[model samples]
Target chain A: MLDAVRTARPRVQVITNPVAQGYTANMLLAIGARPSMTSSPEEIAAFIAVSGSLLVNLGILDRHRRDASLTAVEVAREMGVPWVLDPVKVDISPPRLDFARTLIGMEPDFVRANHDEFVGLGGADTGEEAVRHFAARNLTTVALSGPVDIVTDGTRIVRIANGHPLMDRVTAMGCAGTAVAAAFRAVEPDPLIAAAAALTVMGIAGEVAAAASSGPGSFAGAILDALYGLDAATILEKARLT
Target chain B: MLDAVRTARPRVQVITNPVAQGYTANMLLAIGARPSMTSSPEEIAAFIAVSGSLLVNLGILDRHRRDASLTAVEVAREMGVPWVLDPVKVDISPPRLDFARTLIGMEPDFVRANHDEFVGLGGADTGEEAVRHFAARNLTTVALSGPVDIVTDGTRIVRIANGHPLMDRVTAMGCAGTAVAAAFRAVEPDPLIAAAAALTVMGIAGEVAAAASSGPGSFAGAILDALYGLDAATILEKARLT
Candidate 1:
C-alpha cells in the first residue's frame, strides 16, 4: 500500500484542525503523498476536484471549518474520490457529535475513530465488533484504532497490533494517522486493504520510533524518520497483523 | 530571565496560526510555561484575563483569526498585560500587512519580525537599525530574527549570534520564537532582557539540536528535547551575545 501511494503520489485535500495541519502535511510529504489544505469554502470544491482523495477531520470545530468540510465532502462524493472521516473528540462535545452523525449520513468511504469514539458513534463493545457493526451499518469501511486496531468493510476484517504508548503523548498523532489512511485510500480501491495498510504503517512506525526515542518530543521526530525510511521488507518484518 | 520563567511558570494566551499552535505550545511547555490557544473571539477576552501574557501570530489569516486576534490584543492592552506581536509573512499579503500595521499602532510591548517583515513594517536597512527604528518609533521592544537575531528597546540593543540553519527548514520556527519571547516577557518585565534571553535560548537549543539530528524532521524533536533540558549553565557556556 505504501508502494502504491508512493507510485501514485496522490494529492490529498485535507480539512483538519489547526493543531494537526503542519504535522499532517509533513507526514504526507515524508511518505511521498502531496497534501493541500485550502480552508476557504469558495475554493474547496475546485481544489478537491483535482485532488485524489479528501480527509475531513473535525478536531476544532469552527463555523468556517464546518462549512468548508461539508462542502468538500459533498464534492468528493460527487467526484467519486475516496474520503476518510475522522470524528475526533466526538464524545466531548454534543454539537461535534451531531456534526459527526450528519457527516456519517453523507457516507464517507472510510470512518477512522478511536475505541471510545467508535462507541460514541454508536458502535458495539469490542474493536472488532465496533468496526464490523459500523461498516455493516454504513455500507462502508470502519477503522477502530487503539492498542489493537481493527478495520472492517462489512465482510472482511483486518486486525493490526503494532503501536507504542508514546504515540498517546503527542497532540496530533491520531489526526495524522487519519490522513495516512486517506492517502492509502487514494491508491488502493479496496477500503479494507487501504484502512489496514494505513494502520499497519502507523503502528510499525510508532513501535520503531518508541525504541529510538527518549520521550514524546523525540518520538515525534523518530516516527517521521521511520515513515520516511520504511521499506516493504522492514514493514513485513515488523507488522503484526491478523 | 529563563530562571524567572521556570519559577513563575506563566500561562500564556496564544492566538497564533494553526500551523504554529502545536509546536508553539510544545516549545512553551518545554521551557516551563503553560500555553493555551483560544481562537473563539467570544472566549478570548476571558481567557486572556487570567493569562500572564499574550502572543499574537498572523501566519494564516482568516476571518475568525483576524477578529479573535484583534479582540485578544485589545484586551491584553486594556488589562496591562505584556503582549508579543509576530508579523508572520507580512510582506506577501497586503491585507495581512494592513492588519499588522493597525495592530502595531495599538502598541504591543514587543514586535517580532524577520528581515523582510521588518522592512515591510517600515524598519530601516540592517537588523540593528530595523530593531532600533521600530523600537524608537513605537516605544516598544523590537526583535529582528534571522541568521543573527537582534532585540532592542528604544535605547538598548542586544544581539544574539547563535542559531542554526536547520531552524530555517522547519515551518513556524519564527512564530514559536515569538511565543518564547512572550513567555519570557511574562516573567521578566525588562523587554530587552526578556527578548534577548528568549532568542538566546532558541539559538542555543537550535545549535544543540542540529548536532543531534539527521534532518529537519528529527531536528524538530531534538529542539524540543534541547529546550526541555536547557539550563542556565548551558546558556552561559553556549550563548554568543553582544
Candidate 2:
C-alpha cells in the first residue's frame, strides 16, 4: 500500500471537522499523498473534480457544515471519485444517525465505524454480524474497529488484531484512523485492500505506542511517532492483516 | 525557548480556523507543546481553565465562529493566561478591522500580523509604523511580518531579515506563524522574547524551504521538512533575532 501511494501520489480531498484539518493534511503529505480541505459548497465541486479520492467526516457537524459535506459527497459521486465516510459519534443522536443513513445512500466506497458505532449502524449482535450487515448493503468496504479490527468486502473478510487497548483512551484516534484509511484509499483502487492496509498500519502503530507510553497523553504522541516511523518492511513483519 | 517548552510541555488552548487546526497542533507537538482546539464558547472557557496559554485566531471568521473567538479572549484575559492574537485579513473590511480593534482592547500579550494586515489594523503607512502603533497601544509584543519581520516590545525591536519570497504565495503562512508564536508563548512568559523566537524560526525555515522548492506547492512540503528538521542550535546560529 505504501508502495502504491509512493508511486501514485494521489491527491486526496478531505471535508472534515476544522479541528483535524491541519493534522490530517500533513499526515497525508507525510505518507506521500497530496491533500486539500475545502468546505465551501462553491469550492467543493471544483476540489472534488481534481481529487483522486474524497473523505467526509461528520465530526463538527452544524447546519452549514452538513450542507458542505453533502455537496462534496454529491460532487465526488458525479466525478466518479471514490469516497470514504467517517460517521463520527452518529449514535449520539437520532438526527446524526439519520444523517449518516442519508450519507450511506451516497454509496461511499468505504464506511469506517468503531465497535459501538458499528453496532448502532448495523444493528449487529457482534462485530462479525456488523461486517455481514455492511456487506449485505453492497458497501464496497466496511471497517469495524475494536480490540480486533474487521475489514470486509462483502465476500471476503480480514481481521487485524495488532493494535493495543490503550488506543481506546485517545480522543481522535478513530478520526486519525479514518484519515489513514483515506490516505491508503487515495492510492489503491480497491476499497477493501485500502481499508485492510490502513487498519493494519494503525493497529500496529497502536501497539508500538502502547509499548512506549503509560497513558493517553503520551500515547497520542507515541502513536504519531510510530505512524511516521513505520516502513513497509516493518508493517509486513508486524501487521496482522488476515 | 525550546528548552522551556521541552521542560514545561504546556497545554495551549487554541481558538482558530478549522482549516489550520491539525497542522497547528502537530507543529506544536513537534516542538513539545500540547495543543487543543475548542471553538465552542463554553468549551473554549472550559479548556482555557486548564491550559497554560491561549491562542486566538481570527483567520476564517464568520458569524458563528466569531463568538467563540471573543469568548476565548475574554476567558484568557480573566484567567490571566498569556495569549496571542492573529488578526487575519483584518484589513479586508471595516467589520473585521473593528472586530480586531475590539480584541486588541482586551490587551493580548502578543499580536502577530502580516505586513498588509498590520497596516490595515493600525492604519499605518508602513509595517514598521504598524508595529509602533501596536506597541503604543500597550501590546506587550508585536510582530509585523514581511520580507523582513520586526518583533518589538515597545523599547526593543528585533528585525528578522531571513525567509523566502515564495512564502508570500502561500495562503496560511501567517496563521501558521501565529501557531508557532503560540507554542513559544506557551513556553516563555515574556511575550516579546517568545514572539521573537517564533518569528525567527519561521523566517529561517521559510528561507530553507525557498532554497529547496520551485513554487508554493513544493515549498509547502519543504517548509514542513524545515520546521521538523530544525534544531535549537541551528535556529540560534542562523536566526537574526536582532
**Highest-scoring model, TM-score:** 1
Can you write out model 2's per-residue Cα lDDT over A128-198, one digit (the tens) per residue?
86587766675557888877788887778888888886565444667768878887887787888899888
lDDT of 2 by residue, B54-157 (tens): 88888778877788788887888898888888988888878888898888888888888777787787646555665676687665678878767888877778
RMSD to the true structure for each prediction, in A, is: 6.1, 8.3
For residue A112, model 1's alpha carbon misses the true position, in angstroms, by 3.5
Segments of candidate 2 deviating more than 4 angstroms: A1-15, A19-58, A61-176, A179-197, A201-242, B6-9, B22-26, B127-130
Checking candidate 1 for backbone clashes, the offending pairs are none
C-alpha lDDT of all candidate models, in order? 0.85, 0.76
Q: What TM-score, computed on C-alpha atoms, does each candidate reach?
A: 0.67, 0.63
DockQ for every model comes to 0.18, 0.07
Candidate 1 residue B131 Cα shift, in angstroms, is 7.7
Indicate the TM-score of model 1: 0.67
Fill in the DockQ of model 2: 0.07
Model 1, first chain, TM-score of: 0.97
Predicted chain A of candidate 2: TM-score: 0.91
Sequence-dependent TM-score of model 2: 0.63
